[model samples]
Target: MSTADNNSQYDKFPEVAIAGRYHEAWQGWPQVVAALQEALAAQPRQKTVLVVECYHGVAQQELLKALILPLRPAALFDAADARRSTAEIEALIAGDLTDDPVFGRRSSLPLAAFFDPAKCAQMQQAIAAVSHGLVVVAGTGAALMADGDLLVYADLARWEIQQRFRRGELGNYGADNARADLLSRYKRAFFIDWRVLDRHKVPLLQRADFLLDTHQAGSPRLVSGAALHAGLRQVARQPFRVVPFFDPGVWGGQWMKHQFDLDPAAANYAWCFDCVPEENSLLMRFGDVRVEIPALDLVLLYPQPLLGDAAYARFGAEFPIRFDLLDTVGGQNLSLQVHPTLPYIRQQFGMAYTQDESYYLLAAEPDAGVCLGVKTGTRPDEMMAALAQAAQGEGRFDDARFINRFPARRHDHFLIPAGTVHCAGAGSVVLEISATPYLFTFKLWDWGRLGLDGRPRPLHLHHGGNVIDWQRDTDWVTRELVNRVEPVAAGPGWQEERTGLHPSQFIETRRHWFSVPVLHHTDGRVNVLNLIEGEEAVVESPSGSFAPFVVHFAETFIIPAAVGAYRIRPCGRSLGQRLGTLKAWVREEETPC
Candidate 1:
C-alpha cells in the first residue's frame, strides 16, 4: 500500500497496543506514535500536530513527554477543564490559538481527559489544520475524527490501546486472542450462582401448591384449583393435585441416593410438589410449557405451547419442541418408569405420544448412576415377576433382573427412546432435550415409600405395563445412545447427522468460539443462539444495523427468520479470546397426520 493508504489506515485507529507486563502491548501503541512523530518531524512548519489529552494520568504524562515535547511549538488545555469556559478547541488550532480563554488553557494540559477515547475527534481535526507548524498538545482533546481518522501519542497503556483496537484503531496485535480470553472470564464470573434458592421464597413453587386446608372439614383445598375453575369453567374443568415435595425423606427413597450429596435429613432439598387432585386429573401450567397429565412435580424449562395462548400462537408456529436445562441436585433413583410410544399410546389410550429424549450430563458425583434399557435377554415376564415381587416388598429388583445400569459421568449424553425403561440417577444436572409434551411416567417400582402427608405415593402400574415394549429392539436403544455427531466444524457452520428417530423435528446446533468477524448465512430459517458459555457479542445485520447481544450462561436468543447474513464481533479487551457463541437452526419436518 502507498504511504497515503498506510497513513489513512493508521489515522483511523487501525491498531491498538495494550502495554502492560504482557508483550502483546506493543501491538498498537508504539507503532502509531512512531509513525505520527516521523510525519510531524519531516513536515514541521507546514503541518501542525495537535496532541489532546483528556485528563492527567501516568500513561498520559509519559505519552506527552515522549511524542510532543521533542518538537513542541505550542500547547493547549481544555478550557472546559478550568472553571473558565472559552472558545472551542477547534478554532484555536486554526491559527486562532490566542483568540479566547480556550486558547490560553489549551497551553497547560493533563492526560486524564483521553481516558474515554471517544472524545478525541475535535483534537484530530484541529491538528490536521496546522499543515506544518505549531503541534498543539491539549488535555482532553479529540484524537479521532468523524471521517475515521486518528491521532496517536506515546505513554498509553495496553488496555487503552486495546480499546482503540476494536474501533479499528490499532494494528499488529493478537487482539482476537486477548478479546476472547477477556470475554470468557467475564462470562464465567457473571454466571456463577452466588446464592442458593430458598424454597419458602421460590414463587413458582409457592404458586403451584398453596392450600387452604380446614381442620374442621378434614381436607385441604388447593387454591390453584379454585383459581382455574372460578370463571373459565370450560377451560379449567380439569382437576389437579398440587402437592409440594420439599421434604428430604420422600426424595431420599425415591430419587436422591443416586445423586452426589447424601440427602441431608435436616435440610429440605426437593421443593417440587405434585399438582394432582384426589379424584380427577388436571392440566399443569408452569411458565410457558404446559402438560395435560396427572399432576406431578417435575422441573420444566420452556414449556410446549408456551404458558399462555398468545405466546403459544407466536412461537409455537415456528418453534414447536420446547426444552429445559434440568439440574437434579440430589441423587434420584426414580421408580422404574416407561413412556409409551406413539403407536402404543394411540392404540391403547387414543392419545399420541412422542417420548424420545436425550440427556446431556453436566455434573455427577462418584457412584452417580442411571438405569437405561432393560437387560438384553430379559423378557416382559421376567420384568413383571420382578416388579410383582418388588410390589409385594420381597426382593431388590435393581439387582435381580440385571437391568441395564451405568454410572453417570459429566458430559456423557444418553438418548432414551419411548418404551426404553429408564431413570435419572441421583446427583446429576442434565440438559434434557425431548420431543414430548406428555411426561407419562409409568412407575413400576418406588421402594415402598410414602409422602410427608402419610400417604403412599400412587403407582401407575397398568399404564406403565401397557407401554413397556417387551420385544423392543435393544439395538435401536443402544445405537441412539452411543451415536452423536459433532455439530460445528473448526471453520464455520455445523455438521450434524440424522441419528434420532425424529431427527427432522430437531435442529442442528453448532457451538462456536469466535474471535475475528464471522459472516454467517441464515438461509431463511429461524435460528436460536444459546450462550451456554460466554457473554457479549455484536450481531450485525446485513443491512448494517447492529446490536450488542449479551449471553450469560444458559441465556438464549431467538433470531427471527429471514435475518440473512450477520457478523459476530466480540466486545472489550477480550474481544476474540474468551468469547464463545452457539448457533442453532430449526429443522424442517412434515407434520405427522
Candidate 2:
C-alpha cells in the first residue's frame, strides 16, 4: 500500500541497528524455519514440547503452515480450541465493550478470563499424553495450554491489527465480528482485547526463547529473546523513531499524501501516528530485513531508561506524550470537540489523566482557522440547548454566532486544555501534541456532515455539556492559548522558545530554530520532537555515545532520557538553512498555574 515510501526520506520503515553481537535475528521463511529446527534439535529431551504463543492478530494458520512441514510434529494443539465459545466470550466482555460508537468502559479483565477452565485442563492433558517427537502448541494463549521446553512469542503491532480491521481480515479475540462496525471493533480492542493481551504478553517478553515477527506474509523474522532484549537495551540509549503508520479518515486530506510521499492511490491521509508508542511499531534492522515489534515493548521493558526515572515513577510504564497529525488540508472541518476533564475521565473512563492537547499548525491554507471556545458572552445553557437542537437536525448550530474563530497559519500554536471547545478548520494540517489518553474527546458537532458510513456521526452533547468551560471564551482564549511563545535561551545561530501547552497541561513544549548545532539535554525525561521546518537535521551525542541520527522535515523522533546530552544541527539540504523542531517532554517539576 505504501510502496512509494521507499523513495521518500521520511523513512516510513525507520530501523534501529542492533549491535553485531546481538544481531542473531534470522530473516525469511527459509532462514526462520531452519533456525527454529536448529533450536528444537539442540534441546536435550526425548520428547519436546514447543509452545509458539502469538499475540492477538497474528496469522495463526500461516505460522502453522510454515512450521508443520519443517518440524513435522507428531501432535499439535491450537490454543483457540481452549478459549471460551464465541458467544460466551462476546457475552463476557459486553459491559466493557459498550454500545457507544467510540467509547467503552475500561476493562479489568485478564487473559485468563477469556479461557474456559475445563478446556484449558483438557488441552494440558492432551499435551501431557504426547511423549515422543515434537508436540507443538501454538496460537494466542498458547502458554496456557502447556509449558514448553522452548517457548517462542510471536508479536504483531496494534497499527497492523487496525489495518486488518479496515480490510475485514481480522476480528477481536475469540469473537466473530470482523464485519461489524469499524469503530465498535476498535472500541473492543482498545478497551478489552489489548488491555488483557498486553497483561499476558508483558511477562512473556522476558522469558520467551525467541521473538517472532510475522508482519509479512510467508516471511518471518526470528530473534533470540536475549538478542531481542539486548537490541531493546540499545534502543533505550539512543535517538530512534517508532515505525509510523498513516490512515485515511472521514476528515482526511491530501497534504500528507504529497508531503510525506504517502500512497497516492489512497483516498487521503488523515493521521500519521508519529510517536504514539501505544499503537506504533519499532523496527530493528537485521541483515536486509526489518523486524517489527510493538513500541510499547520498549516502554514496558526498559521504562527506567526509556522514560527516565522521574517519568517512570509518574506514568508507570505508560508513554505520557503523544504526537500525531490531523490532516484537513483539502477536506472538511474536524468535528467540534472537547476532551473530558481529568476528574471526569478518572471517574468515568478509569484513565489516569485526560488529553490536554495543542495544535501546532504544521501547514495551513490562507483561509485556515480554528474554532476555539465560545463567544465572549455566550452562556452555557443557551449553547447546550442549541447543540441539542442541532443534534436532532433542527437546524445548523450557527457556529459563527457562538464559536470564536481564530485565524491559523503555519507555525501557529493553539493550546487546548481539556474542556476547551476546539477543532481545526478545513485546509489545516495539524501536529497534535497531547497527553496519551487520546480517546476521551467528545464530539459535539460535525458541520452536519455524514460519516463515512453514510450516517450522521454520533454526538455526545450531554458529555460535552458537562465538561465545556464556558469561561474559556473569546477573551480568555486570546490571552492564554494562542501562540503564547516566550524566549527561553539562545546561542549563536540558534534560538529557543517556550511554547504554551497551558500550565494545566503536564506536557511542556519547546520550539527551536537553528542554522548550526544546538545543544539539548533530555533532563532525565524522554523527549519527543518533530522537525516542523526545513529539510533535514542530524542529532549527535556530544561524547559519541550513539551514532549520529538524521531527522527529516516533519518526522518525529524520540530521545530516551538516558541519552543525556545531545546536539542537533541542520544537515543535508538544510545544511545552511534555519530548521525548526517542536519538542515535548513530561514536566517533572511543578509550576504555579
Candidate 3:
C-alpha cells in the first residue's frame, strides 16, 4: 500500500493527475534511459534502429522527449503514423454483429487493421532511408527486429491507464458521449490492450534487449538478459503480493472497510481486487526505491515457470485463475447474473476463455443467503418476462419467486459454473475464486437499483438470456453446485479435505487445517491459498529458494509451481484456533508432471 519510497534511494514517486486527484505511475524515465544507454553500448554496431514498443496510453512520445532525444538519435520514426485513423478503426468494428456495447467488442478485428503489414513496411522503409545515423522506432509493433537492432518495451498496468484516462491524459473518444459512455469505452479499450499484450508479451521479452517497468511513479529501471530472467524467476518462485485496490459500488458493504482498515470516509468498500493481475500493481523493491508494474507481467514473462507445465499447456499464457472479494454485509444483493459459456465467450467476445466462478463465503450474518440458478419449474418465457419488467423499472425483480436462494454460512462453497445464474445475497462476505475472464458477467436483473454514479447500470439481458442454461433448475443446482466436503487425510496436528464440487473442472480445491507447520510441495502446479480462519502463517522453503512469505487472515497469496517443497507455520495470533486454509491447483490428472 505504501508505494512511494521504501528505502529512499530514489526521490518520491511523483503523483500524476487522476480522477480529480493524483495517482502514481512509473517513476521518471531518466534513470531508465541511462541504464539503457549502458546496455545499448554492448549491442552490435549494425543495430541502427532502436524500437521502443509500448502499451497504449503510455505517452511514448513524451518518453522520447524526456529521455531518448537527449541521446540524439539521427532519425526518429513515430509509429502513431502507421495506426489506422480512429474513424476507420471504429467503422471496421461496427461491421461485426458481435460487437455489443454491454458485452464489449472484439479486440482482434481493430488490432488486425491497426497492424496492417503495408503500413508497418512503409514505416520501416522510411527508417531505413535514414542512412548511417541511429533510427529510433518509438511505439508498438515488431515490424523491424533485425539481427543487430535493439528493442525496448514500455509497459504500464491497466489500472494506471484508467487513472490517466479519467484525468483526460488519454484521449476521451469525443465530447459527444456522456461520462458513463466514455468510461465504458475506456474499460473496453483496456480489455483489447490486455489481449494484445498477452499475445506478444513473451516474444517481446525474449527479443528485447531491455525491459522498462513503467507502472510505478518515480523509480524506473531497465532489466535484461540474465538479470531479467533471474528477477522474474525470483518473483514466480516466491510468495508475491500485488497492490490491492478497493472500489465502492451501489450495493457496497462495510465489512471490508473494517477488516482491511480501508478509508472510513468513503461510503463503503464493495470490492477488493486483491490479486487480479490485469487491474492490480506488482510492487518490486529495489534497494531503497520500489518499482511497480502490472502483475500480468509474471504470466507474460514466464508462463510455464509461474503457472506450471500443465496449466500452460491448457491455458497458454493466460493466468487461468482469479481471486477477489465481494462484500454484501450491511448492504444488498449482487445483480442476478450468469457468465457466458466457453463457446459463447469465444464466439461473442473473441476471447479464448470464459468465467466459471465459485463463491467461498468468508463471513455470513443471520439469514444470509445466495441466489443460485432458477426456481425448479420456472419456464424460459417466465424468466424473460420478470427480467423485462425489472428493466422497465416497473418493480424490483423478485429473486424469491424465480431464483433459488440458499442459506449461506461461513466457509460455504457455492460453485457457479458458466451458464448457472447466481449472486451473493445481502449480509454475506464472499471470496470469489474463478477462471480469469472476469468482465463477461451478463446481468439479467439489478433489483431496480442505480449505480454508485447515480446512473442505471447497463444490463445485459440479451446476452444473459442467450447464455443461461434453463435446465439448471433448482433441483439440479441444489444437487450439483453445492460442494461436498470429504475428509481426505489426517496427520499429527494437521488434516486435509477434498472440497471440490465438479469433477469436470480444471482446478482441484481442498481445505487444510493445521496446528503445526504443514509440509507441502508444488509438484509442478501453482497453488492459490487463502487463510480462511487464521491470524497469520509463514510460508517458507527450507532450501532458501525464496524469501519466507507471510499471509494474514482473509488474505490470498500465490505459490508458484516452481516452488518445490515448503512449509506453512502458524504465527502470532489465533494459536488456540486451528489455522484453516483453502488451496487450489490444476488437477493432477491434467498435470502429467
Q: TM-score for every candidate vs. truth?
A: 0.43, 0.96, 0.87
Pick the winner on lDDT between candidates 2 and 3: 2
Name the candidate that leads on lDDT: 2
Give per-residue CA lDDT, model 3, range 392-466, as digits (tens).
988877778888999999989998888999989989999888888787888888888888767888898888899
Candidate 3 runs further than 4 Å off: 1-29, 40-48, 94-97, 104-106, 109-122, 142-148, 171-180, 217-219, 350-352, 574-576, 588-593
Q: At residue 468, give the lDDT of candidate 1.
A: 78
- Which wins on TM-score, candidate 1 or candidate 2? 2
Q: Single out the weakest 10-residue window by summed lDDT for candidate 3.
A: 9-18
- After superposition, the stretches of candidate 2 with alpha carbons farther than 4 Å from their true spots are 1-8, 589-593
Q: Cα miss at 579, model 3 (Å)?
A: 0.9
Candidate 1 lDDT over 199-218, as tens digits, reads 11122322321211111111
Model 1 TM-score, all chains together: 0.43
- lDDT (10s digit) by residue, model 2, range 248-337: 878899988987787688898888999899999999886565788999999889999999998998888899999999999898789999
Better structure of 1 and 3 per TM-score:
3
| Model 1 stretches astray by more than 4 angstroms | 1-319, 347-353, 452-454, 470-476, 492-530, 534-547, 556-586, 590-593
Model 2 clashes, total count: 0
